[model samples]
Target chain A: MTENPNVPVLCATGVSAIVAGDAGDFRVLDGVSLEVDAGEIVDITGSSGCGKTTLLRALARLLPGAVGTLSLRGVSAHDLTPQAWRAAVALLPQKPTMVAGTVRENLLLPWTLKVRAQQSAPEDAVLRAALDGLHLSDVSLERDTDRLSVGQQARIALLRILMTNPSVLMLDEPDANLDDASAAQVTQATSQFASAGGAVIRVRHQRTDALASRRFSMCGGQLTETTS
Target chain B: MSGAGGVIVIGWWQLALATGLMVLTGALSVALKLGVAKQLAIATARTYAQLLLLGLVLGWIFGLDSPWAVLGVLVIMTGVAALTIARRAPDAPAGTTGISFLAMLLVGTFITFVVTGLIVRVEPWYLPRYVIPIAGMVLGNSMNGIALALERTFSDMDARSGEILALTALGATPWEAAAPSIRRAMRAAMIPGINTLSAAGIVFIPGMMAGQLLAGADPMAAAPYQIVVMVMVATADITGSTLAVMLTYRRRFGADDIYLERGYRPDSRS
Candidate 1:
């Protein structure tokens, strides 16, 4: 699945968002714009409540009333169906959502979507291999997701996203719930994804800067590139 | 026709006795600080006024024998019922009131008109006596179901919206993500209709059947009428609730299967 490494896979321009709170209307993302090329890992760092998650969701088109021009793989977001565009630019939320089923069923759910109708699930061997690389080899696909720990759920959620084979990965603190080994595995996976001509945008909480090729800081809804 | 034209009559003295009982209950509520005496009084007064007005209005409609008049009344009734049902919805995701209006009007008219005009074969098709009351019976029950469905669906969204949005993230369509909540809400809404069927004749002669019998209808006629109505009402409830859940849940999600943001969530909850 490797392609030209420097292709501009996703580009955003003039994206702005406002959200209401108990206090009043708050501008969470204001005219934020960026571009992520193939093999690019863009790390977003910010203090809590600095709107990093908001910006990521805006880019993903999950935030309503977020006005922006975004193109993925040369196709404008407006021209693509939300389901179709999301299949290419997936945003992994901060908290993992588990359906009432075994891990296997949840992981295979995306294939059942009409947008992904042309695709089929990865075989069990491939899935197990990917899980093993994420330090989740011991986890059984037959295991109930409800019985999994928070950490396990987080990792499994990432695994499901990867199974979709998205071109752009928007991870909101992807390693927040992981221990050192699992976090390392997560970083390794992101690097591997980028190297395979995919793009990664991680909202990082840690001081580590090795994985991301470029870094941006979010403060008061503005995304500014950091000299890294 | 007189208000108490049936075989059994609630004479004014008997009405006085019932009023006394209600007053006693209200007094007990106030004394015990149950905090509902004022509501009890207001409800009682409103009931009296509303029923008195209804009695006069139905008497006039029945006397008129005008089909267009009856149809107009049904339309207005349906509109009010829909809005009432929607008003009970949760204040989230917007446009729920409009959804209820659409569901209630379509379901209410389809079921009510079909039964009264076709199955019952009420001569003139819009006989005010038959059409108005039957429409009320059908719409009233269906309205409850629609309201319950909207409430359940919307509240479930509040609790499980994150899960729903997560499904959207995985490239599922809005309908696919919301199908679970819609199904659950429809089931919850149908409970009352189901209960009515199970309890109908055995528990007590249903209101319509009993009322008709008291008004001098033969058992032969009353029995079939009750059966037809029971089936019609259950159908109406199921149709109303299902349509409401499906229509309203679809509106909650975005046009392109994105989860429409209601407000801010610190942790990426929809």
Candidate 2:
């Protein structure tokens, strides 16, 4: 629980999910609790289908049936609109699909959401700054997204989330598609986000240099903090 | 126009010719072992019986001067049409039946009323002959469009659930997140109506025009009525699909903007 508003950017307690199946129902996660604070990176590792993604989804407010006491920025998720809450705790999926557009259109797609309709589109300077932070300074908005490599697409997806300036970033194996150089750039960018007082929660496939301050293992829908 | 009042009526012998042709086709199918001979005969029998019953019901309603009877018949027809459309969807659509019914009734009644009340200007607006026939035409056409639209909408959104979640994650409303699929559904539903509009005269004469021509109406007069009916049909199609999409897309996301674990798909999206 957020003992202080300045401490944890996001917290989930006793989070559980039961998905209905044809034969019967199955519980994916049970009583999993965690806290993510600004300027901190929490690394989660688990086997596929071990409820790692489910936990991230529950934290992102993307799973409606998930049961939990989850809060973002000390505000109960129930109190915030789904859109606003999701914006505050953005979840980046493993393989993100790119829309049909130039790199600029893909980058600015988040601004077109009705939740952001009231706010003006980010200025070109902001877009450039986001790209520059991700070591994509040479990339231009005019370039077609289709022309970009998988690594570039991964970087762009990261940049897209960073542009929103989400308080907590829940990344699900974001490096699975990234090359060595691209992975390095991503790690640097995430570290920068953490240093700038943003919370980073990531489920890593390989324990590369991700700069996580704490490590946790997810098994059978349960999370245990490890002091490795 | 002297003999146009009665024109030329089809006697029983000439009508029997069509029956004979159908029998011949059935025999040929039977001989060729197409396996559709029984189906053909059953369908023909069902169609004949249904139309005969409908004719009798219309005769009774037309004899009555009460608007209630006409409106009641229209309401029943709309319900039947909605059910038919819902059943026609590829997926198990018990959930969407009510929405489909609302969509069909709203669009079907609105356009049928506009045509019968304003444009055609029938003396008694709810007269059975005018109201029922217009409702039948509008409802039937829009029903197919709506079924396709609903099926497409459900399947598309279910398939694109990930994309939708991404948009939601980026602060997109359910409407914004599901816009592409909704657009696809609308276009899929409307394409047939639009094709009818595009192909009405050039490809071949449509049913309304054919009926008017057979009833001794002027060709030029029939043409204008055909245009009006097509436009009304298109309106019904567009309105029904749009309403269905608008109502159903919200179900993909929960009250708190979270993506549901299972949507319209029988097979889970997990």
Candidate 3:
């Protein structure tokens, strides 16, 4: 079924989160709301601990204390199973976590999940080609993931989530550990994803958001759209 | 009772004479400035007191010869076993005590009955001499297994939060995400049972079999009893660990299928 261009591919309303701090419980995201339509690349910028990552996590339903009304393609997140909702709207955390295995296995991790079991893994040649597109031709698929540099691991983790073909991709600091060149490559890949009718919401510390059509600034647990 | 094959009963004086060895050990520990001296002395004291109390209780229960008496003692033993596990795994979720109690009570009672009623075919299924000892052995072994599994499951989930949450983000179910840790816990729980089974007759004679032989029972009869016990303990360990871990591992996750970081509540661990 074709998606209505008028309807947002992903939407969140009054997304609030209360996280346990070292001192005690504190509000992280307070009534933060946002919407992203297909082919839109949204950028969320904030100071450290400004609830940027927390908001992304809340949207993905990863935070247990988060309260919000989230919808995907006009369908309520409550209507779908969490597994189904997460598969449709995937999150790539800030830290890159690679399981113990060859790079090929790590890249194919999504398909190995039971929720994604119905989808077959792509061919190694296809994966190798995707790596080449991401300017990671030096990284071999047979190489152990632990041996990869953090930058390489970050890119591979991003590619791994993209392999799931999620409609809305939430990235937390995708370029936190990448060099300028590697960071550019990430931006290019995400731009291509957005242009292909997929939605992208990225958390960035830097002000450069060349691909974003809409920019948001989060402060004191609130999200406000900035006039870019 | 002094015949070559007959049982040898130690008098009270002889039992006191045996206490001298433990006293000597405690003294040696103190002389060597070992910090374990106090623990050693306390353990020795507990061993004597506990065994004598057990003998008194068993003597009374055997005299009563009532099925309700046997069941009551077994239930009390199961409760103690559950409490021991709950104490050992303090980091476990809130309902851990209830879960462990249920698991031990069900598996322990089932295994004990199977041994006394069906395997040995004791004349009276609830005969204290048969039922109490069998229930004790089952509950003791199962308590250790379930405790190990419970401790391992929670610790593993905490340590592997990164990998688990990553899997959940890709839509893995809670079971699928926690499967590795559960398997590891189950394996760790089974190791002692496996070792006991393998070393029973070769490395050392098991307690029940050794007691039987010392009491002048036939070696053939003691061997079958020991075999039954080894098999029973292993079976109980498997079932108890599986039940305890299955019932409790989900405590690490929320109802929305998200893994609660460090269990109980969602924190900023990641």
Candidate 4:
């Protein structure tokens, strides 16, 4: 496998995962396959425990029990280091997490990672603009994240992942804790991301999002494309 | 019953008097319904048996004065100490015993050698009378430090799962993600030794100093020896804890550096 723009930005084939449960080890994802091209948004909707999150984790290489082929820009996942793979394919978990720091420090967390050490951090103006785009203009960067509401923290987490410039973004309910207005802003932000030649794959419990170029529904650990 | 160096040895009748103290303690526990009378009796018995066995073994080993015998005894002491450390930490992963053994063995031997060879400057340096006791002390102190540090590292990593996952998702290496937890663990492990150092002499006479005094060593000589013992123990504790943390923190992550969401399990040592 080699890097090529014409190839799908992210691809997975026959990915399966077995998560340990109280009862026993059980399959959460079974032989799921997907291909995502640049500048497209793919929405995955499913009931709770139906494996939407499992599929994203498998793609992100966060689940060691997950097995199958995963590749980015035609390069097999094995070709890239785990750090390199994760840097390019980032997975935002369901619950938003903020380190002990001010908003600016949280926003710059990705830059502090060793994988991103070589790259210069974004300027304060750039960060302010991004925060503004997310309807956080009223919040000061110096404000401690612990004081921020869960909704605001969620938005900051989304922006933090965006700052890393991942090629493919996998979000697990990015707008779960947000108000309608903030939720719309999150949609708009993702839309803007896809418009900039990035691919997005997100799990949503609500109806199919209009912004999604393709929609898929999962049931009983299997995924099927649905006509939108 | 007399020990070397003008030591005032306790007679069997005197030991019987100490046994009476334990019996009184057991009676008090029974009266208070503390449910510890049986355990106290067993522990008292074990204490007498173990100490007597230790005294006998040391007497024989001290007389041999062979370097191999001293080394063998030290290695065995380290092995037992490591096993105890591993068992003491309920949350540590399975291979913890092996790692603890290695950390204590290496750190204990190195510190003991430096203390005897350079500091105390024992001629031949393998005299069991000097080497065995010093090595035993080093292993004992380092064992405690490694256990505390390993336990803290595992528990802290488990508690800070969200932070760890966030960092790992953002492309941090396992070490990078665990550095904070390791720092806290190292601090937690080192605190006891630091406290001992600070409280030495003022709070209470330490075990080695008291032992020397009981054995009738000169107060001036015992003071310097106790100082060396305290400093060397602190050094061994810090170094052993560091090595153990460094070796074990990576176990919190899996193949491909995935944050083991379940954290580590004793059954899954690999």
Candidate 5:
């Protein structure tokens, strides 16, 4: 008898999603199933319009048109309150959104929400260290997010997600706008996170360096794992 | 000149000057992108002409010292102000414009009525000269504020929708997702009113005070009234605009994300 594939830290079974309209209902994922054990980095790569972003959104429970059984550690994504689902699974969108404020303000915004309000604020030194590890100076934290370069903004956005310490991180084209240095920072961070038992699911257009535990492709509205 | 009832002569040029002043202000507002100048000019002219005609009809009514006429005119002023606000904020939800207008009337009328009726204790009939002008000023300013607030609120929500969604995913409640945008829209709405209040005396003599002086009122007397009107206008504007923005936020977002209106293009109509 085959063991259940859904026994991992995060699982999406028989997932299907559509976008735009009911008439066409452009199917993005059909009967897609995936699993990520604790402390693994999974990469999803495919051509444009291959539904990579949609799959990530589905995992985050941010896609209204997505129909599936998505669960975190055996709890159904549908059963969890939106707040609960989001706090456990966070998605970093392709185009990082920066509110008009100081960099620190944007970084600390998630903590201000009632769901995460009880969490301790990230220490100033810890925040500064994250910025530095990402090759960003402490001065960058004081500057307005709008003033930062695109690469810096991307890293800062990722770092902000890290501050919340979500169990499952779903990233869509996170490295699309990043330069070599920022991209290196992202790889390092993901490696560190995975080693620490945090799971990461990311979508990329090209095969990225330093991440290949599990790879998948979306073709004809279905996800198929690519052989190593 | 008759012996018992004398002929009360008025200058046509004085009427022309007042009309010209109203037109000039209306035109200036349009040129400055404050509003639709031509429409405002027509509306102002129409209002002035109607007021003159109303004065003529009410001359006999006031002579009888009837309080009902005063009450009727006040109600008409409130209704017209409400309608104008409704028209200005059409992009808002179906009833939002009407709601904002009603809020404006409630705030403007409550303050003006309380101050004039209870505090100032103006005589019977309450003289349209005092009540009408004050009400018009308060209502007009509040309408602009509400319109601007509604525009800013919708536009800001549209622009910052991604951030709003991000917040929602980060466990922000719907209102929590919208709070930043709401605060920003309210602040933008208050800019004009705040600027006018801050620079009232130094920037330029406001129209009401200047008109009072031209109409033979003492400058000292007009100054106090102008100050009072400015204060009342600011209060009404802040109250109405803030309420309108806060109340309309839920309509802008969904349970899980920001709801983009179908075929909605940003600032396309504006």
Candidate 6:
């Protein structure tokens, strides 16, 4: 099929996944198709078992054993190297994983990876600004990430991903465990990211005011855009 | 000093030393949480008894002066070293069994043979005294190193698989993905030997030097040998640990990049 040239930043078609186990395979995603363009925030809401998270992972090419046609920035997801794909479209998993180190070290982790090693490290001012935009104080940078509260950890996780400067950001329940003020900060940061030409795909159990654009409902592994 | 014929029988003191050694080994075992106190006590007692009996048997073998007996003892020592290494590392993969056995054999044989044969120029018939003790020292150091390496590598891999995958996704090669964890584990594996080396004279007199002195060697004469053994042990520890960690990566991760079996559960008791 001819590709859309508003050429969505991330796209997937006929993507299906099965959770492998000893008993049998349980289908998680089936023929799921969606697209997110630059400067767009796509909110995907579904019940617990509807594979919204799996679909997001499929788009990011992070889901193992997933079968589908997925692409980012007009490049086939399957053809691009994982590093290139991740640099283009990164996923922030449901439970944020913090490497054992200080906040600055965690923030600078993506730079240490060979894929992004050629890129110059972010300046101290830029990193501090990103942290500040997430409502995190400059002092948070010196604290151990493991010692941060859940809300603080979530904000730091987002800041870490943002430091990579990926074109597309897929977050699974970015606001799931956050307090009201932290959730608002996430929404504000994400909205700013979308307005600045980054694609945002968020999976949540309930819709939030954070998503100001299109909203989609995932049911029985099917997605349909709705105004509700 | 007052014994008949002025022989001054100190054999009882040796017996007491042996008893005290058993008690110390048992206490250390308990303190390390290696096993139940009673089980460790029994194991220590059995170990001392076995060593004493082996010494008597070796005395006879030495008196007989047969090449076959010497070969037999070497084979037994190799077998014991291999088995002990394997047992201490139960979580290691089957491939590691061969790796560890070969490593113990190669390192222990190379160091002991080269030191005694080429450097010391001990008589061929005197191989037992030099080769057995040196081999035992090398094998023992390698065993601890391998155990630490295997445990550290696997645990670090397990705990940091996500970080590794993140790195891989970020375009790091396999070696690059594993480099940091491997380095950390290698350092950790080498720490015990490093610490012993650092604290050698100030903290404790190593057993080998103390034993040599007890056997009537001048302290000054025994110093060089102790230093040699320490250097050899450090070499064995570093070489064995790095090799073990390198070999473990092949078994720990699958082709699809998922952790395979529980190859090296760092939490598992040895």
How many steric overlaps are in each model, in order? 0, 0, 0, 0, 0, 0
TM-score of chain A of each: 0.93, 0.92, 0.96, 0.96, 0.92, 0.91
> lDDT tens string, model 2, B103-214?
8888888899899989999987887778888898888877888888888877787788777777877888878877898788788888888888888889999998999888
Query: How do the residues B1-270 of candidate 6 rate in per-residue lDDT, one tens digit apiece?
Result: 444433345586777887787788778878898877788677777877898897898778768777677667766766676677667766565577677777767777677777777767778834676766776788789878987787677667667876765555444555767777788888898899999999987899998998777666788988888988898899888887777668666665543343333322222213
Candidate 6 CAPRI category: incorrect
Off by over 4 Å in 4: A1-3, B1-4, B263-270
Residue range B22-101, candidate 1, lDDT tens digits: 89999999899999999999999888789879989989888888988888888788789867875776443466667766
**Interface RMSD score of each model:** 2.9, 2.6, 2.4, 2.3, 3.7, 5.3
- Candidate 4 per-residue C-alpha lDDT over B171-210 given as tens digits, one digit per residue, 9 for 90 to 100: 9899989988899999999999999999999999999999
Whole-model Cα lDDT of every candidate shown, in order: 0.81, 0.81, 0.88, 0.89, 0.75, 0.75
Top-down DockQ ranking: 3, 4, 2, 1, 5, 6
User: Per-residue lDDT of A1-228 in model 6, one digit per residue for the tens?
Assistant: 234566887778888877653455567787888878888988988888788977876676656666878787677765766667777787887777777889888788788777777799887788788888887874567789778888888888888887777788888899899888989898888888888889998998754784658888898767888874
Give the best candidate by DockQ: 3
TM match of model 6 to true structure: 0.75
Task: Label model 5 with its docking quality class.
Answer: acceptable
Q: How far is B172's C-alpha from truth in model 1 (Å)?
A: 1.9
Given candidate 2, what's the lDDT at residue B145?
80
lDDT of 5 by residue, B47-140 (tens): 8789789778667646655567666666676677667766776656556756775677677778777657775567642665566666667777
* TM-score (all chains, Cα) for each model: 0.90, 0.90, 0.96, 0.95, 0.77, 0.75
Mind listing the fnat for each candidate?
0.75, 0.72, 0.77, 0.70, 0.53, 0.30
- The predicted structure with the larger TM-score, 3 or 4, is 3
User: Runs in model 1 with CA error above 4 Å?
Assistant: A1-6, A21-27, A207-209, B1-6, B27-35, B264-270
Q: For residues A1-228, write the lDDT of model 5, one tens digit per residue.
A: 122345677888888965653354466788788988878888888889878887887787776556778888877766777787888888888888887899888888888888887788887788888888877874566798878888887888888887788888888888887777778788888788788878899898854776758888788778778855
Clashing residue pairs in candidate 6 are: none
Query: Per-residue alpha-carbon lDDT of model 4 for A1-228, expressed as tens digits?
Result: 355988899999999987766676778888999999999899999888788987887899988767899989989999899998999999998889998899999999888888887899999999999999899999999999889999999999999999888999999988887888889988999999999999999999863468998899999788899964
Worst 10 residues of 4 chain A by lDDT: A17-26
